[model samples]
Target: MDEIVVGIDVGTTKVCTLVGRVEEDNSIRIIGVGIEPSEGIKKGAIVDLGAAAQAIANSVERAEHTSGVEITSALVSLASANVASVNSRGKVGVSGGIVDDYDVIRALEDARTIAIPGDRELIHVIQRGFVVDGQDGVRAPIGMHGYRLEVEAHIITALAASVENLRQSVASAGVEVAQFVLNPLASAEVVLTETDRQMGCVVCDIGGGTTDLAIYVDGDVWHTMVLAVGGNHVTTDIAHGLRLPIAQAEEIKKQYGHAIRAEVGLEEYFTIRPFGEDEPVQINRQELAHIIEARVEEIFSLTLQEIKRSGYDGLLPAGMILTGGTSALPGIRKLASKVMGMPVRTAKPENLVGLVDRLDSPAYSTSVGLLHWALSMSAQDLAPPRRRRMKGESNMNLDAIKNFFKRLLP
Candidate 1:
């Protein structure tokens, strides 16, 4: 029997719900997709519970109707400026002079003992790498002979209140939040290749309200962050610059937006009627590009700043992989490379089968990645339990150990 999985991506500009089936070859077939305009969400946080709930409900209903499956629990995408990450090391003595899965879990559990604030909630505890005894860079320690084991972990957290609000909104839609995957991490699942992870790369997901980032090195996450500014800011700038309504400004931006001013032809122009103007006025496309360029530059500048702040800016030899809605903007890859002084490429879901007519853009990377994550989690459940004793001694379970190894592996 094929296993079914669902992912609900609650983004700033839209909410996408995807239902996929795990085929025999482990390929994901997109069986259902629901895309709806987001309401009551700003910068990835819920501002109005009722509006957000209705929007999620509508998206879920559409997916259910298309796939003939009732949605229950789903892996949800999350992004907010309140999200933060930290790196720490965990250590544990090998129980039987061999570093087993149990020992690895204990090490990760030790890593999770950070002093987080009361207002924040822990989301992910990803093992970056492991060390056996004093030897560093041990990728898999299970069955290795060692007296001591250490694991380096990257921990992500978010504001408790914001998470609860978003949770309540999904709950209202009758869907349980199985896990909250950060936006850039989800996007990285779809866009980043094995080489990108083994080398260094940054996943930049520019959505409507939030710009999410994740830095990877040695096939593990090193750092992550979410910026409050995104494409909506560019649209807002155009609206104010042209004295037009937000809707009109958004339309024009989509139709004529460019991240580089020099790339736009000076003779090209578009017509739009601003407030208090009876007739439509011809607006220079260069002017619109100018407005967009300023905002897009600032966005990358901020991203670069954050990358530098994380101290991993120099490690990214693969540069950046750009995704999300705003990444579809014309000339964005060149502009991003120019501003960040690094190679950049735009990516989206590829090699998709079944109901994938609309999932071919960079905008749906996170939506599709959630299905991959769900599949991995399902695999973790089928992993064989360790045969050794010590059943009640450890606080962590066998499933948690398998999951930790899943994250630890490339």
Candidate 2:
């Protein structure tokens, strides 16, 4: 089907809208791409709906102008900030003496039965793998004979208010919310190879507002997290340390930021006028690297901490894959390797075919990946044909559910 699909990545620093045309050969041709500076959003949460909606509209209009296709509905890449995850299992008896689609559906439904808080909304229920009877790791169990079937799934949830606010902003831009795909999951769709995933690895998407983490074990997501720290924090550090404007600090960080200070030379210098300064100050390049390295180290440190928290830090034989805007900084992968004590590499989308010059960057990983993810889900017909009765519930929908529910609850 030659369908036109759109994906809008609503980031804290930028809003990127991409329009792609699915060809007969199944290749997605990038017809349009629009990226605009984000406003009314902080830390991936919509703080001002009117301003955020205007930004979305601006991005969407640009894409429409370039592609000549009016977008009515689109998939969104959601930030993982305040996201919660858990692995769940569901089992059902085989019907008609064999495991069929209905049986598989029932198993998935059973897996999704978890105690979700009233303030949280379920976004994704991903099947990690399956089991037939007592045998495990069944990728496809349909048509297999078994008295019982079980499914292991990775469930992702987001704050309900956050999701609704984002939807309202997108609606103001005149686009219906087709689905909300997690940023890390979308990025993983295109960046992570089958071998990388099977061998086990971690994906760190260091964006402007938050550092998103995804750990893959046995070729499926084992853990997901969004840290309230990222590239913007690094910029803020530079701004404060150097006494420069946030914009200028950001620009210099893009030009000279490095994660390894030892590699920088003391003789190298960059002239910049600190905020409220009449004259420019010649600052040592190594000093700038020092400031940048401090924050970069923290980002990687937190990422490693999360991996260890997942109980799979030592299982990642494939090491870590770094992407996102912040991952583009120089010496990032090397620093990652040093900090995490594992092999590390920077990556971007490699599977998309079209006007791909801009999309082939770590920053656009989520934006381009959403195209592949959204279309794949559509083709798979992800929603079940019917719903079954839920099993016993427990408060396992998010990360502890202690603070989130307590704050929102009366």
Candidate 3:
């Protein structure tokens, strides 16, 4: 039997779950998937515990049915607006000629020793690169002669209360939390390649209530940020601009909104019923597209400003890859390309079995990436035990290592 792992994406607009099995060759087979309308979340933060738990339960149940497997735990994506990241460096000395895994742990511990005030928790530690002795960019230093080992990493942090609340909500759904993967990092795993990162690329995940941005350079994440504005804001702008009910406005935006007005004809019109009016009113499609285009321009402008602030403007040879639900808006790529002055394309999850057709859309990238991430982590966890048995060494204590890393934070 294949070992199964589950991935849960809790977003402001939706909650999605994916079940995947790890193959012998380390590839992932997506066996089940589920999505449900989200409640109790605003701008990616859980506002009401009860509502969020119910949403998680609903999605998890659907995924279990589709996969025909029981899921007790999941690796979740963390995309709360409160999350932030900082870069840090650390160095350690290797006692023996060989650089073992323990030396790697010590280096990471040194990097995480920076002072952080109360109410913040370490979220993720991204390994940027390693320097062995005087040589840099060494991917692995194990079994190599090196007295000094240096590591540069980005330590992501988030509000402790918010994380605790999310954990409680998931536990309420009766699921064990295996790990939390950064949302944009997960998106990058599915959409970006080494060459794209080396050439500098920005991944914009335009979710329901938040837009998560991750800038990559030289095959490493340079910066990460989350904007509290997203598709929900567009819906609000349309509803307020068009004098329609919120539900009706969302329906109109989904069905008719376009991000570029130049492609729409001036005489093309659509009808929408006002909140109180019984008869539907006809409006020019260009007018609607113009409104949407304005908001989209503002979004891309802000995103450009963020990239500029990172000092990566004119450096991104690969330009940008847009994903998430908002990217599905018609002509969004054109609008983004025009405003950002760079090549823009939509990103989708690429590899999957049984659901390749369904997972081809950009909106499902994060969910699919989460599945891949869970499987990768599981494989890493299982490697040491198998290695020890082959080498006739004592059974390696994996749980101890996990606990050590966990305790290094708080």
Candidate 4:
């Protein structure tokens, strides 16, 4: 029996369904991956339930065919302009002058007891770090002698209506949504290394309708935000500026778009089918680059503003790690580095094996991260290790795998 886990990434531009089998070393082996152009969704929110459901069904069917397994449920990525975040604290007294797992659980429970609005639902309550007896920056308290325990946590919230609509659409497709994982956290799980997190870094995922940002310091998430600007906005600018249709504009952007205008020679040109013109119109490639540059700069500028607002702006020395669909643009690294005044690099999911080579690209980062996040959380829910298991120990337990999924949901 294989421990199979599925991840569904519903984005503004496409819907991706991936089926992964847990291997002997607890790594993911890609068995099947399906993708199709997204419709009936906008800016990560469901606009038409029927259309969204059909897209989900088709993607899941394609993946199932390749994996030779029927997927009844999946872990979905949660993203939208409505996501919000806040930090809170909780404290509890230790029993027997020692902090135990139960005491840590109680402290966490108390930490999450903030007065969230009824209209908004809590998505995740992640601990930043814990303190024992007023001692700050305590990473682990279990088995430690302490009279008091305190926890500082970061809470993420989302609009109930938006999340419910997304869940309904997935349900309509006949697949249950096991949980709604935050998009930034998912993308960061695979892209950022532990050293990067410790040195402070920002994971920026440039999707079609949103640019998700997650900041980490000392190996804990300190800030997160989702901006309502992305690749689609740049495409729209090209379409309107060149009088080309949206499809053609998108094609031109991917085929010829550049982030820096100064580097592109003015003599280089690309042809496009302009509206009301029989023959194609020749446009200066430099001009196209200029148009893209403006929008890209604005996006980065807004991102910088958000960093400033976070007040942890100066903490990240490791700088930015860019991923997602839009980060594939040529010279994007240079543009981001120039605008952000920090080191910039592009990344995709690197912790993959088996039939997943095709998924080794920026566009598939979020999708891969979703499955990785689920597997990690599932591992955390297991019993603690007592020495090492025998060499013949079996890792394939379907009941335990099913229980893993059950533990993931709220």
Candidate 5:
């Protein structure tokens, strides 16, 4: 029997679920996928528990039907603006003169001991690098002989209340929260390459209610930030500027919004039928383009300032990789490049062995990445030499594990 894993992405605009099985060859075969319109979420934070739970339940039900499996737990992706990150360092003496898994874990724990605010909980303690004695840049010092060990890591923190609310919502949907992954971190796992990270890159996920930014350098996540602005704000802008209803503005933005003014012709025109108005109003493509360009440019400009504030602008030689629903907007990459003064390209999630057609879009990257995160967590939990069989294993247990695997087999 194989191991099954599930991933759930709870976003401001939607909830998505994905299920997959880990094959013998260590590849993931996706077997189920689902999405539902989101509610009770504002700026990536849960405002109404009941509404969020309902949305999650809807998405999970759809996935269960498609995959024919009862999912009880999942690795969830979180995109709240309440998340934050800081750098910390730790060092310890290698008593046995040998570095091992225990040493590594201890070093990480030591790094995590730094004082954080009472309201914050550590989300991730990513090991940047290890220094064995005086030698630096040791990716894995395990099994090496050294008298001292030092570790540099980034400690990501988030508001405990916000995280607890998310967990509660998932629990209300009848699913256990196996893990809570930071949204940008999960997106990076799928969209970023080793080369890109080594060369220095920024991953910008323009979500429905928040824009998540993660900057990587030398294959390490150096900085992360979430802006309380995203594609939804663009929609609101269109709604206000054109005097149209929010729904109509959103539709128009999806159908006609272009981030670069040059992409739209002055002669081209589109009609927006405002709600409560008897007649449809005609608007030039250039006019709509101008509105979109202004907002998108503002977003890019702010992103650039964030990079500068993070002190990672000069480090990003590979430029930026834009993902998320908003990245799908026409001409966004061009506008980002022009404003950031660096090369920019749209990114899609990677490393899936099945369901390529269903998981190819930027809108689903974070959800798909959540699946990858689950697999990674499972792998870490079952690291080599730790697999033990229970003495009284029963048929029921076997059936449960098998059923779980069957649901994930593509």
Candidate 6:
């Protein structure tokens, strides 16, 4: 039987659910998609539990109706402002004078034993690299002759309350939360290339209420952060500046907004009925662009500050790969490049098949990337050499080992 994978992306602006089928050649066919406008979510956190749960349930129902598959459990995407990360190192003595899977796992386990607050919940422990004995920069320590093994890991955590709230929302929709994958990490699975990772790059996903940042160096995650501002801030600016309704402001921003004001012609205009106006008024495209440029520039400025704070600012030679709904704005890439002083490119879900007509935009990167994450996880579980074990331990069951080691990896 073909493997089935599901992913749910609950964002500030929308909730998306996707059902995918794994093909013989390891490609995924997206058989189902459900996208609905969000409510009771602010800056990627749930504000109203009932409303958030209802929104998620609606999205799930739509996906189930479209795909004819009963949804039970799925990997969900998370993007809360409470997200934070740290770097730690661990070392372990190699059993039997040789580094093996268990040795590597032990090192990672040790690295994960850092001091965390009572309210913080551990999310991910990604292996940055490994060092065997006196040797450093060892990509894989398995099978190498070494007495000691050390591993460097990047640990991500969030507020325990926020995580439980999200979990409850998904549960209310009748779906079990298989795992919670960070937003930018999930999006990275689809938009990033192997060369991009090895050469050092950042994945900047600017969604409605949050700008998710993930720095990848040496083919591994090095830093991650979530800024509390996003595209919706620009819309809010427009709403206040033009005295228009929030809905109308968002519409105008999407239709006429440009990241760079000078790039827009002064003569170009659009009509909108502001809150106090009796009839429609003519608004210059340049005027709208001006409002957008201010907010957009601030967004990148904040992003630049974060990159520098991570101390990896000088490391991103490959520049940034931009994705998410807000990235679709006109001239955002150009503006981001100018603000950050790096090469920027906008990306989306590509080379997709089956019910993917509406998913080609950058907005669905997280939704599509979730399926890819699931595929990778499934591959790891089905890998060979599963029977190999250390001489002392023979009591571990297959499921126990699978769960234990899977948590050790990303």
TM-score of 3: 0.91
Q: Candidate 2's residue-wise lDDT over 138-245, tens digit each?
A: 776766889999988788899999999999999999999998988998889778999998999988899999888888889778888889899999999999999988
What is the RMSD of candidate 5? 6.2
Report the candidate with higher TM-score, 5 versus 6: 6
Error of 5 at 270 (Å): 1.0
Model 6, residue 257: what's the lDDT? 89
lDDT of 6 by residue, 83-189 (tens): 99999998998868877677777788899999989998888888888888878888756668999899888999999999999999999999998888899999998
Clashes of 4: 0
The regions of model 2 sitting more than 4 angstroms off are 381-410
Q: Which stretches of candidate 5 lie over 4 Å from their true place?
A: 350-357, 382-410
Q: Model 4: clashing residue pairs?
A: none
Q: Which one wins by lDDT: 1 or 6? A: 1
TM-score of 1: 0.95
Q: Lowest summed-lDDT stretch of 10 residues in model 2?
A: 401-410
Worst lDDT 10-window in candidate 4? 401-410
Q: Which candidate would rank higher by TM-score, 2 or 3?
A: 2
Candidate 3, superposed: residue stretches over 4 Å from native: 356-358, 382-410
So what's the TM-score on candidate 6? 0.95
* Per-model TM against the reference: 0.95, 0.92, 0.91, 0.93, 0.91, 0.95
Worst 10 residues of 6 by lDDT: 401-410
TM-score of 4: 0.93
Over 1-410, each residue of candidate 1 has an lDDT whose tens digit, in order, gives 66999999999999999999999998999998999999999999999999999999999999999999999999999999999999989998897887767677678879989899999999888988889989999887776899999989999999999999999999999999988999998999999999999999999999999999999999889999999999999999999999999998898889999999999999999899888999989999999999999999999999999999999999999999999999999999999999999999999999999999999999999999999888887776634345555644554464556564645421
Of 3 and 4, the candidate ahead on TM-score is 4
* Among all candidates shown, the one with the greatest lDDT: 1
Candidate 4 lDDT, 1-410, residue by residue in tens: 98888999999898899999988889898898888788798888888888988898888888899999898889898889899998889899986687655576677778778998999878877778889998999876766899999988888889999899889888887789877888888899789999999999999999999999999999888888889899999999999999989999999999999999999987999888899999988999999999999999999999999999999989989999999889999889999999999999999988588677678789888899988877876665544232323444545343453333223233
Candidate 1 — which residues are off by over 4 angstroms? 382-410
